[model samples]
Target chain A: MVTDKHYAALDQVLELAVLINDDMTRSLAQDGLTVSRTHLLWELRRRGPSTQRDLADALKVSARTVTGLVDGLEATGFVTRQPHPTDRRATLVTFTERGVRTVEEMERGQQEFARLLFAEMPEERLDCFSEALGEILIRLREASRLTDPRGGDQ
Target chain B: MVTDKHYAALDQVLELAVLINDDMTRSLAQDGLTVSRTHLLWELRRRGPSTQRDLADALKVSARTVTGLVDGLEATGFVTRQPHPTDRRATLVTFTERGVRTVEEMERGQQEFARLLFAEMPEERLDCFSEALGEILIRLREASRLTDPRGGDQ
Candidate 1:
């Protein structure tokens, strides 16, 4: 049975997630960007230049959806498509200079947010909180894996 | 300065949110529902019944979007529209029997998930973890409010 405290904690986490998402949406909208487009940009930042096919597989989205997202990002000047270095039949998506700077700013903003949350927190309490979060993440991942249909054979 | 521990905790929270969302999406797919549809159902369950205008206001979505979601839910037999008792121009969206049962199941599942996460935890540690979450939630909300354009006048 879940205690009232457990329920409270769970509610807090969910509310925080929703609030974080709303904040992100609003922030991204200022740049005329959507979450899906930012996600594509992030993938490019992490993977360097990538083909649309690879991006589709990485995002678990269809080729058409990836194409649409790439088109939107390219139009927004965040990414550009070029002929693959070797594969004549394929095009690679890469971040523009502005895109790199924007991604770096996003990373800096995330770090600043974390600092705002934890700057005044006691070191010991922060440790405890981190451990609790780490443990919960492990358990949640295991639970999700168990329920995931694609993992049914595992 | 934010420590590596802070970054790890934030990442864990974000990853947990994404995983939770993925799990919910998969579960709702089994019921032919999307997150927006479920949000409507949840609002109905909490508010008893609501008009499309009211739902749009509560959800911060457009009236047309709410209508589309309600139409989909009605087609699935999860909800139905009834004429308002006094307001001739208004119709209230109410859940069907199946809808009520499904909402109850969703609520119970949430409690079960909380229990699974905290059942084995020590009471003292749980208290500490809850306190940490409560504190962070307070800070996050304030931060979001400060950044919210709608709250600028405040």
Candidate 2:
């Protein structure tokens, strides 16, 4: 039975994500970078630059997420998004001079944030939750993806 | 440590939420309702209408969430927000005639969705996960809510 408590818990997850992003954006402002900015810069450098789609896949994030990151990075002069000449559907994401220099710093900051986020989590449970979450995501993806708006693959 | 798998899982949670919302919105469209609209109408019916802030608190939802709900409901002539003369900042939300008739249908749809969402879950594990999620939400709320951007309760 999915009780009202379950509903509350689900709502909490949504709020928690927003809160986490807000806090990260605020804290990163001191260094002139947001969480999205840092991650995108670091990923671009690590992957030797890539298309937005490839970057999304490599980072295991959504295309919309990558777009948001690129938006922030571009606004901050940390990245440039260029239309890929060979692929009309693709956007090339490459580091700016500033981004190249800051990528290492961003990588370090990313690690620090990750450490802080999981500092109190029990490793065993975190691993279990991660695994469980993976399964749920797969099921959800199957239910919602593969089937297009017309109810079939695009 | 937040490894690649952990990050992947986190991204999955986000995408899953999006997918769940998309599915719900589609399901609700048949009756000229969105998920937030349906939930808000049902809540108002069950809780006997109340101040927006009080309703948000009781539902463990954000003010923004309530605002979105009220936006849809008000647009559809299912609810109204009236200024409280005594409390200058408060807006009381009350169901309209359409809302009263729709509430029962919304409740049924909500239950059907809940059953489908949790059909495969073990009750014991679901309960455990719900508890864990509740704790995470409290920590997130504490970290983010105390320091407001405009530095006001609003």
Instruction: Name the top TM-score candidate.
Output: 1
TM-score for every candidate vs. truth?
0.92, 0.61
A75-153 in candidate 1: lDDT tens per residue? 8888899999899988999989988999998899889878877878898888888777777777777888888876632
**CAPRI band of model 2?**
acceptable
- Candidate 2 lDDT over B26-85, as tens digits, reads 667855577656767767887886898887876667888888888878888888888886
lDDT of 2: 0.67
DockQ of predicted model 1? 0.69
Off by over 4 Å in 1: A150-154, B150-154
* Model 1 lDDT per residue over B79-154, tens place: 9999999999999999999999989998987888888777777877777788888888778888888888767223
For each candidate, the DockQ is 0.69, 0.35
Candidate 2 docking DockQ:
0.35
Query: Per-residue lDDT tens digits of candidate 2, residues A1-154?
Result: 6677555545554455556656656656744676556666667777876898888877657889988888878887888988897989888988888877777675565565554445466766666565555655666566666533655333
